[model samples]
Target: MSVLVLNTGSSSVKYELIEVESGERLANGVVERIGEDAGRLAHDGGAVEGRFADHEAALRAILDVLGDISPEAVGHRVVHGGEHFREAVLVDEGVIAAVERLAPLAPLHNPVNVIGIRVAQRAFPGVPQVAVFDTAFHHTIPPHAATYAVPPEWKVRRFGFHGTSCAYVAERASALLGSDLSAINLIVLHLGNGASATAVQAGRSVDTSMGLTPMEGLVMGTRSGDVDPGLAGYLARTCGIDADEALTRRSGLLALAGVSDMRTVRQRADEGDEAARLAREVYCHRIRKYVGAYYAVLGRVDAIIFTGGVGEHDAEVRAMSMAGLERLGVVLDPARNQAPSTGERAVSEENGEVAVLVIPTDEEWEIARQTLQSVRRGAPQLGDHA
Candidate 1:
C-alpha cells in the first residue's frame, strides 16, 4: 500500500507518494502559483505549465498526473492544530470544522490545508485521510517553556511550529549517533524559509524558539523572528503599518538585506554590502543564542542537528552559527563543515563533547508514515472516489 502526502500552501500544493511498508518514495511533485496568471505542476520528471484558476484545479491536475496510482490513504500537513489536536487525527466533518475554527491561529496556512483535505477527500473518496500537524511534535514541551507570562484570560502560549521536521531529523540524528533516542539530548535547528530551534530532551520537546506561531522563531525568508513586542505598536503608531503584515510578510531577511533569499543576501554580503553583512550577523547571532539557551535547557546536549534548506545546504551558515561556541562543547571542523556531502553526517570534531551534524529533513515521508499509522489504527473510511 502507498500513502500520499499533501502539503498545501496559499498558492502551492506539494505531494509525495510513498510505499507504506518500505518507506520508499514512488513519486513526488508540486503545483505552484495557483490562482495566478500562470501556474505550473511539476511531477515525476515532467512539467505542466498553465494558468490554473484555483486550488481545486491544481489538485485535480495533480490527480490527473497520478493516473493509475491509487494510494490507500492520504496525509495532510496542517500548520496549526491548536490545543485541540495533540496528535494526528482522521479527517471527519468534526475535524474539518475544528481545523477551520482554528484558522485564526495559522491565518495563512490552515485554510489552504483544509482546501487540500477537501479536494483530496473528493478526489480519492474512501481513502482514509489524516491531518498530521506541524505543531503536534512540540506538544510535549513543558508548560514552563511553552507558556508565556500573559494574562490567564488571554490563553496565549507557545505553540511551536516545524515539529514535523524536528521529529524526522531527531530520529535521523539518533540513528547517525548510534545512540538510543530517549537517552540523548539534542538541539534541532530547522533553518528553512521558516525557521525554528527546538530543544529535545529524552526524545521529547522541552523548549522551542517558536512561540504561539511560526513568526516567533529564527529569522526567516519574510518573517521577522523575534522582534520586541512593543515594536508592533510602535510600527502601527509611527509607520501606519499593520504589525502582523509587517512582521509576517515585510520583515526578516527581506527588511534587513532587501532580499528574502539567503543566497542573495550572502552574495551581497560577499560584495561588501554592509546591510547584507549585518543581516547575516543578526541571523547567525540569533541561532547561536538559541543554541546556547537550548544547551542550558537540555543540560548536556548529545548533538546539535542542523536541518532544512539553509541548515543542510549552507556550509557558511552552519559554521558561522557555531562560531565562538567551542567553550560550550560545540566545535566544528572547518574541513568537514565545508565538505561537499549529502545525507546525515557529522561536521564536528571526532569525540567532541557535543556532536554537530547536518541531517536532511524528510517531512513528507514523516507525514506519510504518521498517516499510515493513523489509518491502520482504524480511522473512519470515506466513500467511493469522486
Candidate 2:
C-alpha cells in the first residue's frame, strides 16, 4: 500500500509518497517560499519556481501533480500536540478543531499545519488523514522533568519537539549497539534549522532540552534558546524591540554571527571571523551542557546519538559538541567520524564508554509508516478517497 506524507510549514510544504511495506519513497519534493513573491514547487524530478499565494493552492497543485495515485492514507507532521495528542490521530472536523485549538502553543507551526490538513481533506475528500506530532514521543517525560517553574494556574510546561526524528534515531542506535532499546540509556541530539537534545532512559524520554516552546533549548538556526526569561521585558524596554519577533527571528546563531547556516558560520570562522568563532563555541557549549545535564539525569548513558541536518552532515559540529566530553565516557574517533559513511552507524572510539553515532533521520518515512498503521489499526475503513 502507498501512503502520502505531508509536512507543511508556514511558507513551505514538504511531501513524500511512499510504498509502506518496503519503506521506499515513491515520490518526494518540496514547495518552497509559499505565500511569497518567489514561491515554487519541485516534484516528479523537476522544479517549478513561482509565487504560491496560499497553502490551499500549493496543496491542490501538489495533488494535481500526484494525479490518481489513490494513496491509502495521508499523514501530516503536526508540530505541537501539547498534552492532548500522544500518537497519530485520524483527522476529522473534530480533529481539525482540536489541532487548531492548540495553534497558540505553536504559533509558527500549528495554524499552517491545519491549513495543510484542511486543504488535503478537501482535495482528497474522505481519505483518512493522520497527524503524527513532533511532541508525541516526548510525552513520556515525567511531570517533574516536563514541568516549568511557573505558577500552576499559568499552565506552562515543557513540550519537547522533534520527537519523530528522535524515535527513529533512538531505535537505530539500539540496533547498532546490539542491545535492547529498553536496556540502554541514550542522549539524542537533533540539530537542524531547529535543534534540541533529548535524554532517553530505557527507551522512554525522561527529559528533553526544549521546554514549553522550541525557543527554550539549545541554540537553533533562528531562535535563541535558553535566554534569560526576563530578557524579553528588558529588551523591549531598552531596545524598543518587540520581544517575540526579536527572540524568534533576530536571534540565535543568526544574531551571533549574522548568518543562520552553520556552514557559512564555519566558513567565516575559518577566515578568522571572531563573531563566527564565538557563535560556534556558544552552539557547541550549549550542546555540551545538555550532554552533562542529561548524563546526570540518565545516571548512565550507553550512546550519544546525533541526527538531523547539522548532526549528520557536519562532522566538525559533532566533534566540537562532544569535545572534552571524554571524561564523561563520550569519545569520538577522528577517522571514523570524518569517514564518509551514510545511513546509521557509529563513529565513536572502540573503547569509548558512550558510543557516538550518526543516524540519518527519515521523518517522511516515519510519517508514512505511522500513517498506514494509524489507518489499518483503528481508522474507519471507508474508501481510498477518505
Candidate 3:
C-alpha cells in the first residue's frame, strides 16, 4: 500500500506519493499559481506551464501526470483542527463538515484544505483519506503553557502549528544526538516564511511559541508576532486597518526591510542597509529570546535543533540568534556553522554542553507515516478502485 500526501495551499498544491512499506517517494510534484494566469505544474522531473482555473483542474492535471500509479491511501495536511482533533483521523463526511465549521479559525487555510480533501476523494473514491493536522503533535502541551490569560468564557488558547515538522525533526535530532528520545530535551526552531520555537522535553512538547494561531509566533515573512494587544484598537481607530490583516500580511520582514525573503534581507543588510540590518536584528532577537525562555523552562538543555529554510540554510542567523548564550552552554562553532552541508550535522563546538544542529524538516514523510499508521489501526479500510 502507498500513501499520497497533499499539502494544499490557497494557490498551490504539493503532492507526493510514497510507498508505505519502503518509505520511498514514488512521485512528487506541485501545481502553483492556481486561479491565476501562467500557472504551472511540475512533476517527476517534467514541467507543464499552464493556467489551472481551480484546485480541481490542478488536481486533475496532477492525476494526468501520475498516470497509472494508484495509492492505497491519501493524507491531507489540514492546518487547523481546533480542539476537535488530537491526532490524525480518517476523513469522512462528518469530519469534512466539522472542518468546514472551523473555517473561520483558519480562514486562509482550512477552506482550501477541505477543497483538496474533496478533490482527492473524488479522484480516488473508496480510498481512505486521513487528515494529519499541524496542531496535533502539540496537544501534549501543558495547561499552563497552552492556556491564555483571558477569561475562561472566551475559550481561546494556544494551538500550536507545525507539529508535523517538529515531530519529524525531534526524532531525527534524537538520532543525531545518539540518545534515547525520551531522555533528551530539545528546542526546535522552525524558521521558514512562518516561524515558531518549540520546547520539547522528553519527546513531548512542553511549550511552543505559536499561540491561538500561527500569526502569534516569531517574526515571520509578513506576519507581525507578539505585538501589543492595544495596537489593534489603535490601528483600527487611526489607520482604519484591520489588526488581523495587518499582522498577517503587512508586517514582519516585509514591513521592516521592504521584502519578505530572508536571503534578500540578509543580502541587503550585508550591503549596509540600516532597515534590513535592523530587521535581521529583530528577527534574531526574537529567536534568541525564545531560546533563552525555553532553556529556563527546561532547566537543563540538551540540544538546540534548527530546521526549516532560514534555520537550516542561514548560518549567520543561527549563530547570531544564539550569540550571547554562552552562559547557557549553547555555543556555535564558527567554522562548522559556515560549512555548507545538506545532511543533518551539528554546528556546535565539539563535545559542547549543548548541541546546535541543522536538521532539514520532512513534513511530507511524517504525514504519510502517520496516515499509514492511522490506516493500519483500523481507520476505515475502504476498498480500492482501479
Q: Per-residue lDDT tens digits of candidate 2, residues 152-185?
A: 9998888899888888888888889999999999
- Each model's number of backbone clashes? 1, 6, 0
Output the worst ten-in-a-row residue range by lDDT, candidate 3: 377-386
- Which run of 10 residues does model 1 get worst, by summed lDDT? 377-386
* Candidate 1 local distance difference test against the native: 0.87
Query: What C-alpha root-mean-square deviation, in Å, does candidate 3 show against the real structure?
Result: 3.8
Candidate 2's displacement at residue 74, Å, is 0.6
**Residue range 177-272, candidate 1, lDDT tens digits:** 999899999999998777889999888999999888778979987789998899988988998989897788778998999987788899999999
In the range 272-303, model 3's lDDT, one tens digit per residue, is 99999999999999999999999999989899
Quote the positional error of residue 68 for candidate 3 in Å: 3.7
All candidates: TM-score: 0.91, 0.90, 0.91
After superposition on all CA atoms, how large is the RMSD of candidate 1?
3.6
TM-score between model 3 and native: 0.91
Order the numbered candidates by TM-score, best leading: 1, 3, 2
